[model samples]
Target chain A: MNKIEVKGLYKAYSDKGRRINGYDECRLPEGSTVLHDINLSIKRRSFTCFVGPSGCGKSTLLRIMAGFEHPTKGWVFIDGMPVNGPSPRHIFVFQEDGLLPWMTTRENVALGVRDIKDSDERRRRIIEYIELVGLKGFEDHYPHELSGGMRRRAEVARALITNPDILFMDEPFGALDFLTRLQMREEMINVHMMFDTTILFITHDIDEAIQLGDQIVILSERPTNLRADIPLAFPHPRDFTKGGLAALRRDIYFQMGIHTAL
Target chain B: MGEDGGERKNGFMKGALSKCRQADRILPALTVVVIIALWEWVVRIFSISPGVLPPPSRVAAALWGLAKSGVLFDYTVASLFRVTWGYFLAVAAAVPIGMFLGLWPLGRAVFNPIIQFLRPISPLAWIPLAILWLGIGDKPAVFLIFLAVFFPMLVCVMGSVAGIKVTYFRIAQNFGLTGYRLYTKVVLPAALPEIVVGLRITLGTAWLVIVAAEMIAVKSGLGYLIVDARNSLRMDRVIGGMVVIGIIGLALDRIIRRLETLPSVRWKRMQR
Candidate 1:
């Protein structure tokens, strides 16, 4: 079953001088198009990775799907209903600095389950989610006090505690150190395995897309259109140094205008 | 053998650290003492008349006299009462209006020019009008202090709210928080650190205005004490009043600063 469907999606910015709020990274000139006729279908519980070039509007696309911004013209349907604005059932984990710096880890995680009427049940779930993200002993620490990776974990816990049907992550580990990014990727996979929620992740790193994606959607440079949609059925601990994964990696590099032979 | 050496080194470092902290406390006191001594010596060397520039001893004596007569306490309480009322009133009004303006661009556009225009005009300019409208006593002084505090605090609160990271709003929206819930749960807490800073700054402005306000509009505050003392040719009492004002200003600043140390808002300091 398809969890989300994007039909004839197109986005453009009419304001030339002023930068758009929330999409500060992608500054377009007057009437310049971004995503051009983007169409995608994300299956339920499948981890889809969006890989694109810099300023290719991948984040814009993700934000549009999450209803943070409206497309110039198109429709995004989640569970057969059109998305009007951001909904509680769909959570977005921003690339960085998403955790409220003023809030403790416990308080931030509790944000998702704030509607739970039962106090004991809410406390239990908040603690459970905190432990699930391996932030047991540091519940009282603010976002600034936690390490970068720990802050990311807290954000993920906050998102997951709501049990959203679709989790939109925009380059969640882009700011982490190499070792922390690798560790987070493993933890991310563990999270996917443990939860039944569908995940839509955006990244510019090809290796990250190859490693974490169940289906990889490649996007082209400005006025971005869907370049390729490749579904990887490879099992866990799949080696990318050799075999089909390596060849596929080379193919992606070539398609992205990067020569691996160099 | 190495363990004992490490312990000795640790003890040395601890002792050095304590000594450094002690220096931090003592240096300010030492400077105050030196300045007072210099002031006294200059007064004695110049043989300055008491009416022109009283020595520290005479100023201290005058302060002791006020303290004994209990007028100092009364003056201090009056000034504090006006400041407290004016500052709280400004805070109560400015925070809500600031939030509204900060959140609503159209409203901000409508009102920002008026605020900016009024902001540059000194609060002293309002003295005649305050006196005319409210008459004498604490009312006019409080009104002037309110005028002094309200504009800057409004601007500060608005800036603080506007400065909140867009990501936090996105998170709030994603969680379906809207309207009052959004303000109470997300906006208030997120803008608190900056608001507390704003409160501290505006309180300083309020304290400054109160003295000037009291000099013209009221009869019981420290400002009145200084002016009334000058009328009687008591330079010592005037200086003493100034000293008391300085001390109370420092105390108010210290109290507001403690709010910044709260765990919820402490991230501002950490970020710095």
Candidate 2:
């Protein structure tokens, strides 16, 4: 069975004025049709990258796949069970350091595994992930105290500590600088190798889509449908500066509606 | 971690000291000092009636006199207890109900109209009804205070939940949290900041209501003390009571301010 399956999804958000009666709807108040007629399947343990233009519904599709959002008209299945809400066994990391502002780096990393009942094992795993992200001696620091790169690293530690079967990341490195972005990419590749979790990542950067994806899915404009599903052959720690990777970057540029700006 | 993070938790105090030395920060405080100085001079220069417009010094003297008698302390404690009981009761009832109303559309729709219709009615207006229901003493005063505090704070909490960043909610849901976990994990923490703000404002309003109610409802609190002094024409005690109320209100507000200190501010020099 595919680790994740999206079958003929249709979702629309109706944004209307606030009610005098003070009811809050889960859907957006401003009508936005984010996803329309999306059908796809992600094989187990594959590194899949979702690339598209702004507001093309890549993020929305990722949310639906993880069951954070419900489709207005379709069904999603993960591991043969219908996707109803968040699957605890699946982990998601987003662009912002979703680290609780109050929690120390350690507490945030330890969040998922803390309830495991075995204190020592949980602590050891938390420390291991923290150290894996190359954040040593900074476990006590809060999100605001860390630099942007460091905060993202802490997020990485938090996500990976859970040992999830599927990892969903939305624009994870889109906020970092060039040098830091490269470093984060390398760390992600290493973490993927270590855990072998099926990762579905969304990114606007074509180079990022090229460097990390085993198969890159390019989405069309919104109410979005598929444009292309191209596979990247380059293995992890793929050097973007290398000529082979650079060529793939050129192809993704055309796909994103930006014609080889580089 | 910087040494200052550990040693200088007194950011406001340190700021004041630094400003005093730099002269820029202290400038604002200095202006207030100057205004007080000028006001003191003017009142004394004009020889205003000790009753009608007592000088700052006379108010200070009256404060000292009350401190010595310890009767001022007694009145102060009564006021504090009344406000505290009412404020806590309002919060205990309002927070969870507000959370429920904010989370579910049905509850909000059902309760919201009722809340809105009643919101316009002042707590003072409810005094007579409160007296009738709870019978003319402490209960009426407490009920009035509760009415004044509960609705505004419940609205603030609803606003806080409404304003929660979409990403925060999404992240929590992605972890399979629903039911009680959803409330304890995502909604509560995200709404904390705005809820604290509501609690602070409610406490201030509660203080006012308690004092006002005590003057008529109950007999021994600061509000009654003020009325008794006024009727007896002991203006010094009245001024003392007013000052005591102001100081207590200021102290309560400062406590809330500390509690509501921003997440970033409390985090490793995130504010400074």
Candidate 3:
């Protein structure tokens, strides 16, 4: 089943009446479009990665899907209902650090599950998620006090504690060190298996897309449109150093028109 | 004999260490003493009239006289009371209004011009109007202090709220926080460091205004003591009042600086 559907999505940045051309009408300013004619359907409980070059509006599309932004023209339907605004049923993990500096790890996570009325239940869930992210002892630490990877884990814990139907992660591990990034990818896969939630992950890294995505949607340069779609059906614990993975990486690079040096 | 010898050695070492510690304080004390002695010498050598410029000794004598008569106590209490009430009232009013203006563009557009216009006009400038409107006494003095404090506080709080990273708001929104919950849980805490700074600054402003306000609009305060002593040709008492004001201002700033060390509101720069 399709969890989300987008049709004819167009977004442009413009001010009203700035480009008025006629007595009867005003046209949208030219050269302002970010995403044009975007159509996508994301399947339920599947991980989909949107891969694109920098400034290709992949993040904007994710934001539109998560209701952080509105498309200039089109409809985004979640469960056949048009998304009006950000909902608690969907969570967005930003690329940059978004953890509130003033809040402790426990408070940040608890902020996610604010709808939980019972105090005891909220505390239990907060602790469970904090431990799930391996931040058990650091619950009382603020974001500034934590390491980069720990802060990211705390943010992921904050998102997962709410148990959203779909999680939109826009290069959430992009700021971590190489080793931490690899560890986080594995952590994410473990989390996906445990939660079975729909994930729309955006990234510029082709390897990350292949590693985490069940289906990868490639995006073109701005004004961005869907370029190609690839499906990966490799089983869990698949190694990138293996045979099939190397070919897949080459294919993705070919599609992106990048020739890597041997 | 061994234990006694060790105890004596320990005591001697402790005394030496304490004396070394006290040496740190003695430098500033020595500077103050030298300055006072120089001031006394200059006055004597110049044959300066007592009415024109009182020496340090006469200022001390006058301060002692005021303390003995309970005049200094009365004036200090009066000034402290006015500052406390006026400054707190300004904070109580400014914070919420500032938050509202900071968050809402329309509200800011409506009131920002008026605030900017009033901000530059010193609170001392408002004394005559305050007296005209509120009548003579603590009311006018308090009113002037409040006016002095309100604008800077409002600007600081508003700017603080405006300066919060957009990421924080997005995080709060993503978690389904709305309205008052959004403010109490996210906005207020995030803006607290700046708000504290604003409060500290406005406390200084309030203190400054109280002296000026009391000089014109009230019967009793440090400012009144200065003005009254000057009129009576008692330069020593006037100098004593000025010294009291300086000491009080220094203490107030130090107290606020100490508040910056609190864990919950500790600024990044101020944190050890």
Candidate 4:
């Protein structure tokens, strides 16, 4: 059964004329459509990766599904109930610098299970989640003190500790260096395998999508529409150097207007 | 031989760095000494009247006299007392009001223009009205200092809260944090560093206003000491009062600056 469903999702930012403050200057112009007719459904516990061109609004789609943003025209259903606003049942792992800088890793991860009535249980789970993300010794370190990958891991742990039914990640590893990104991808797969949650990840990297996603969804540029949805039936440790994975990679490159042969 | 060269280079760099650190400590003291020496030299060389400009030695003697009499202690305490009452009261009121205005756009839209209008008007300009409304002594002086601190602090806290990254709020919302939890968990911590900076700047303004306010509204602070000395043709005592004000201002600034180094707000330094 589909754990999450987005039907005829559309988003547009209406410019409210001249804004007095500098904060509103970056917003899209009046009636600028970002996401148009985005329809998607994800099976329970599936790992889905959304890949698109820059500014194609894949993040918008994810945010809408996560209920951080509202769709201008259609409905998003999570387990057949409409999403009115962000809920603890679904958590978002921001692309960069989401963990509050003022908080240490332990304090930040503790925010996830703050509602738990038992103090001992909460403390144990905080420790458990921190260790799960491989941030054991760095629990007392602030976000600014941690390396980029470690901060990302801490954020992931914070999200996972809540035991949400769905996790939305918006390019969570995009800021990490090449080596850290590879290590995080491996850890992410382990996390997916161990957790029962449905994961919807947004990334611009096609190769990353091919490696991490159980199903890959491609999106087109502004006024974004679903271009393709391809299911990967193959097993883990996907090598894009040869076989069906490589063929798919080539196909995605072609779809995105890139010539891998060149 | 190569290792010896590397060790010698490291030693040389370390020595240079220590010398730089020493200079940081010594330079300001050196400048103060040089300026005082120049002032004394000019006064002595020109044979100027002491009333026109007293030498540092005479100023020091006047300070010694005030200390011996205990009036200096009393005046300093009076000024600090007023500043404490006014500044803390402003902080208590402005922070919450600023947070509310920052969180709600409608409140900000209505109040911001009025605040901006009042902020530009000098606190000294309120002396007449403050005297009329609150009457003499600490009340009027404290009121002026409060006026001096409040508007700037409100604007500062508003900016700080408003400047909090939208991502933090989204994270808080995603975790089901709302209302009071949102403020305590996300808003307060995120805005704290900037708020501390605002507090420091506004404390300086409060100190500045207290002196001027005391000159008119009260008669027991450093401002009054300076005015009384001038009336009695005691230029040395006036200079003594000015020096005391400068020292206390520096002390107050140093005290507030310590808040910036706290573990929670220390991320502000790293951001730079």
Best by DockQ: 1
Tens digit of lDDT per residue, candidate 4, span A1-262? 6898888889887757323343312356678899889888999999999998988398778888888778899999999999989998899998887898889999999889979999999999999999998989999998887889999999999999999899999999998999999999999899899999999999988889999999999999888999999998878988988999888888988998897553
Q: What local lDDT score does residue B27 receive in model 2, on the 0 to 100 scale?
A: 83
Most accurate candidate by TM-score? 1
Residues B1-272, candidate 2: write the lDDT tens digits.
Answer: 47687567678688888867788757867996897688689888897777786666777787787678887778788778777777788898989988878877778888899999998888988887888899966778888888989999889887777666666666676555578877886788767866877888888999988888888888778898889989988777787778788778888898888876666335423523
Candidate 4 Cα deviation (angstroms), residue A134: 1.4
Residue-level lDDT of model 3, residues A38-81, one tens digit each, is: 99998899999999888738888988899977889999999999
Candidate 3 local lDDT, residue A177: 89
Candidate 4, B63: how far from true, in Å? 0.8
TM-score of each: 0.95, 0.86, 0.90, 0.94
Pairs of residues clashing in candidate 2: A15-A29, A15-A30, A15-A31
Superior by DockQ: candidate 1 or candidate 4? 1
**What's candidate 4's i-RMS value?**
2.8
Fraction of the native A-B contacts that model 3 recovers: 0.40
Report the lDDT of model 2 for residue A80. 82
Docking level of model 4 = medium
Identify the superior model by lDDT, candidate 2 or candidate 3.
3
Model-by-model DockQ, in order: 0.64, 0.43, 0.22, 0.56
lDDT of 1 by residue, A87-187 (tens): 89889999888887888999899889978999999999999999998999999998887888999999999999998888999999999999989999998
lDDT of 3 by residue, B1-272 (tens): 27699799999999999999899789878998899899999999999998899999999999999999999999999999999999988889999999988887678889999999999998888877888999998888888888888899999888888767666777877887889998998788878888888888888888888998888988899999999998898999999999999999989998998867765577344323
Write down the lDDT of every candidate, Cα atoms only: 0.90, 0.79, 0.86, 0.89
| Residues B1-272, model 4: lDDT tens digits | 27699799999999999999999989999999999999999999999999899999999999999999999999999999999999999999999999999988889889988999999999999999988998889998889888989999999889988877878888898887889989988898889998999999999999888888877777799999989998999999999999999999999999999999998788867855
Tens digits of per-residue lDDT for model 1, B1-272: 27699799999999999999999989989999999999999999999998899999999999999999999999999999999999899899999999888887789889999999999899899888888899999888888878888999899888888777788899999887889999998898878988998899999999999998888888898999999998999999999999999999999998999998898789867855
